[model samples]
Target: MRVALLSDCYLPRLGGIEVQVHDLARSLRQAGHEAVVVTATQGPDEPIDDVPVERLAIPLPGGVPVNPLAPPKVRRLLLDGGFDVAHVHMGVVSPFAMDSMRVALGVGIPTVATWHCVLAHAAPLVDAAGYVERWADRGAELTAVSQVAAAPLRRMSGGAPVSVLPNGIDVARWSPGPRPEASTGSLRVVTAMRLALRKRPLDLVKVVARARELAPGADLRLEILGEGPQRRRLEAWSARHGAQEWLSLPGRVTREELHRRYLASDVYVAPAELEAFGIAALEARASGLPVVGPRRSGITEFVADGRDGLLVDDDEQFAQALARLATDADLRDRLGAYARSTPVRQDWGEVVAQTVQAYGRARA
Candidate 1:
């Protein structure tokens, strides 16, 4: 099958959806399908993992970094791409993605629209937008990364079937490996996520600080990986809390380095409350790291409370969980073993197979 993966963001941009688009395209191609990525992110023509990418020139409105492109260009691309099916990854506020979906359906192509965001507070607005887009075309199939993300859309779709298709990670690439022991005599707590407002990176600093206070004589070190608009604020917060020596914000690192960090770390902390499908937490668990995150979010889909890992309610509980994991190596090791053994999701090949089934349904 020839597939066109459309998105508002792509490579060189560090985001969860961007990574998912790239990985999905690659997986599709590996499954003997011709896959191409269409994006409004302006960049030089590049091939990610042998998948061809077409980057269209689009203007950023109101000085915002989002790619809001002209609909005509998207229509022309859909018409000219010669793809058998179109898979559009929709963001919470993605004008480009919606435009692509409309154009793909306008061209009478089988289209699969996958929602990748959890619009917690703005869900009503998103549902309103969905209602507005209801006139476009109803033939296209709909999916979401999690039930939390699918709720508002399903409500707005007026009973249109919205399938839940969670994101997949390259478990083999991120598999467990021998990690060098930490030189610093401290419990290593690691989290790799875009330092955004929804992620609550600043709150992570407070959690780490409170954990240090609760665990007397226990050295708790936090290593935050990934970069975003909140980097400066998080840095300032780390300094303000007098955790500069213990907390290190190394920004984004290479994929290999990330896997190594996960293997070496004692605990993985996910502070994001609105994660549609905590891929980072899954990767950490695959790397044999015990996860500590909120129970209400999508991380609950994988991280089992009091079994594979510990799930908390608020920042206070999060801090206490961290402190307990930091002080007890036996508990950490046992939880880590359980985390590695827990069956979360299928591999990329199986995910691609499921996606192909969705495409077949869209075409039928």
Candidate 2:
């Protein structure tokens, strides 16, 4: 199969959707299908990691991904490229991806559109626009990153089937060979997320602060990885709370570095309640760290409460759970052991197979 993977985001930028779309294209090629990335994200047409990239980007201030003049170029490509399928990846507000979807369908190419964001915050605007419902009516196959993300799409589609096409990870690559024993008695808690407001990065600091107050002598330490707009706010919060000694905000690090940190850490905390699918949490779990996160979010797909890790309903409960895990080595070990033993179902092989199935449905 010759597939064109379209997205408003791609390599040279790092985020959930960008990373997943790139990985999905690579996975397809590895499975013996020819996959090319057609992105509006500002980057060269050169192949990234041996997979071809087609950029329809228009220069804009702040390097915005939207390309107003991309429709004709996208239609021409789909018409002339002989693409077997056009797989469109969308975030909550992806105008470029949306435009690509329309162009692909207008050119009569088989198209699969996958949503990578939770729609709770954008439901009203999306509902009012009715683009998704109309797309469903026009036979554009729809999928989402997780069941949590699919719920609103299903509702808006007015009974169209919304499948769950999850994000993929390299499980073996992430698996820690042997966790290094902690030389210091201090417990390390780690989290990786773009320091954005929606991700609730500051909430992690508050949770840790409250946990320290709850377990005054537990020697708990936190390391938040990843850089974003919330860095200054987090720094000021840490300073005001006198948490510099216990809290460390080391900006984004390489994946290998993250795996090393996970191996050295005791637990991973995901503070976002609206997380569609916690990829960072999954990576930590793959590296043999127990995950602590909300029960209602997509983290529940893999992090089973009381089995894989502990789940909390509110900030107070999150703090209490962190304190309990910090104080109880046995519980931490148990959860981490389970996390290591149980392989995630979102491995690239499984995800590639699912992608093939979605393509089949789109073609049908």
Candidate 3:
């Protein structure tokens, strides 16, 4: 089967959608399918990792990944590519992806549109716009990365069913490893995410600080990975909380480094309430670390409360959970062992199968 992945973002612009779309294409090709990425992201048109990429990027200032004038080009590409399915990946505000979906449907191609971001707050506006209804009327199949992401879509889709098409991980790549003995005697807690307000990096820092206070005798150190605009604010907040020594924001690191850190860390924290899918937390879970995350987030898809990790209701509960894990070695060990021993169902093989199922539905 030949599939064209339509997205507003792609490789060289590191993001959730970009990475997932790239990995999906790679996995599709590995599964003996011809997959090509059709994106608006400004990058080299060269094939990445043997997967073909067609960039319809408009060179705006700051390399923004949006091309208002790419409709004609996108139409031509789809009409000529002989693609069996035009799989469109969308975020909350993906004009290019929506346009591509319209073009694909207009040309009578099977199109599967997947939403990668949470749309709770924007559902009303999107429903009012009636795009989802129109797409449904035109025989387009819709899906989302998780149940949390699918909820809003279900409402705005005008009774059109929205299925879950989760992001996948390389299980063996992040499988449990022998954790190195701690030399500092501090509980190494880690989180990997862009330091943005939506991710609530500062909020996580505060929760960790409160956890330290709740378990003063238990030494806890937090190292946040990834970089964004909130670095200065997070640093200043940590200083104000007098947590500079224990809380470290190491900015962005390579994927291998992240995997290594997860192996070394004792626990993972993901405090984002609006998280559509917790990819970082999944990686940590795959690496045998117990996770502490919001109960209402997409992390619930994997991290079971008191099983793989502790799910909290609010910041106070989040801090309490962290403190409990820090002081109670038995609980932490049990959860970590469970997390490590269990395999995540959202592996590439299962995800590819699910993608094929969606494509089949779109073709029908």
Candidate 4:
């Protein structure tokens, strides 16, 4: 089967959806299917992992990098490329993805639309848009990364099923290794995420500060990997709370470096409450690191409370979890051991099989 994985962004742009799109294409090929990536984000016309990437020249309005004129080209691709299925990954408000779905459906091509974001506050708008898109392509298969992300779309789907397809990670690549020895006596907490408002990087700093206050003499250090618009603000917050000395922002690193960082750290923390699927938390667990984060988000799918990791409901609870993990090495070791033993559903082959099943349903 030939599949076209459509997205608003692709390689050269580091994002969860972009990575998933690329991985999905590679997995599809590994499953004996031809796959291609059709994205609006500009990049060289080169094959990544042997899967061809088609980067369209799209317009950016008000600095929002999306192609307004993507529908025509998408329709042309569907009609000309002889693709067996069109799998469109939808962003929060992606015109290109939506347009691609519309064009694929209009041209009588099987289409699968995967929702990858949890629009917590802007759900009404998303519902409205989803309603219009569903009306436009009622036969298209709809999916979400998690149940929380599927709620609004489910309402828009009337009585139709909304499949839950969580993101997959390369388990072997993220497997546990010999943990790097900690140089400092302090507990090392690591978090990798974009420093965006939704990720709450500033709140993480505050949580680290609170943990210090709770632990008193127990030393704790935080290393945040990744960069975004909130870098300056997060730095300022760390300085204001006298946490600059203990907190280090190393920006972004390669995948190998990320795995090394996870092995080097004592614990992993995810502050994002709106994560559709927490890939970083999954990687942390695969790396033998116990995870600490809110109980309400998608990370709960993998991180079992008190087993693989600790789940909290509020900032104070988050701080207390950190404090406990920082002060107690035995508990950390036990949790970390359990985290390593626990198996997460991240096999790329399984993900591809499920995706092919969705494509078959779409074609039916």
Residue-level lDDT of model 1, residues 15-74, one tens digit each, is 788899999999998889999988877666868778798877555553233554557877
Sorting all predicted structures by lDDT, with the top scorer first, yields 3, 2, 4, 1
lDDT of each candidate versus the true structure: 0.82, 0.89, 0.90, 0.85
lDDT of 4 by residue, 194-312 (tens): 98999999999889989999998888999999989999998777778677789999999999999999988889999998888888888888888999998888887788888889999
> What RMSD, rounded to one decimal, does every model reach?
2.7, 1.5, 1.5, 2.2
| Candidate 1 clashing pairs, residues 3+ apart or interchain | none
Best by lDDT: 3
Query: Model 3: runs farther than 4 Å from truth?
Result: 181-186
Q: TM-score ranking from best to worst?
A: 3, 2, 4, 1
- By TM-score, the better pick of 1 and 2 is 2
TM-scores for every candidate against the unseen true structure: 0.91, 0.96, 0.97, 0.94
Assess the local accuracy of residue 311 in candidate 1 as a C-alpha lDDT between 0 and 100: 91
Global CA lDDT computed for model 1:
0.82
lDDT of 2 by residue, 192-289 (tens): 99999989999889999899889887889999999999999999998997899999988989999999989888889999999989999999988888
- Candidate closer to the true structure by TM-score (higher is better), 1 or 3: 3
Q: Residues 1-364, candidate 3, lDDT per residue (tens digit)?
A: 9999999988999888898999999999999999999999999889999989999998899889999999999999999999999999999999899899889999999999999888877888998999987898899999988888888888878798999999998888888898977533357899999988999998898888898889998899999999999999998887786888898888899989999999989999999998999988888888888889988899988888989999899999999998888888888878978987898888899999999999999999
Between the candidate structures 2 and 4, which one is better when assessed by TM-score?
2
Error of 3 at 218 (Å): 1.3
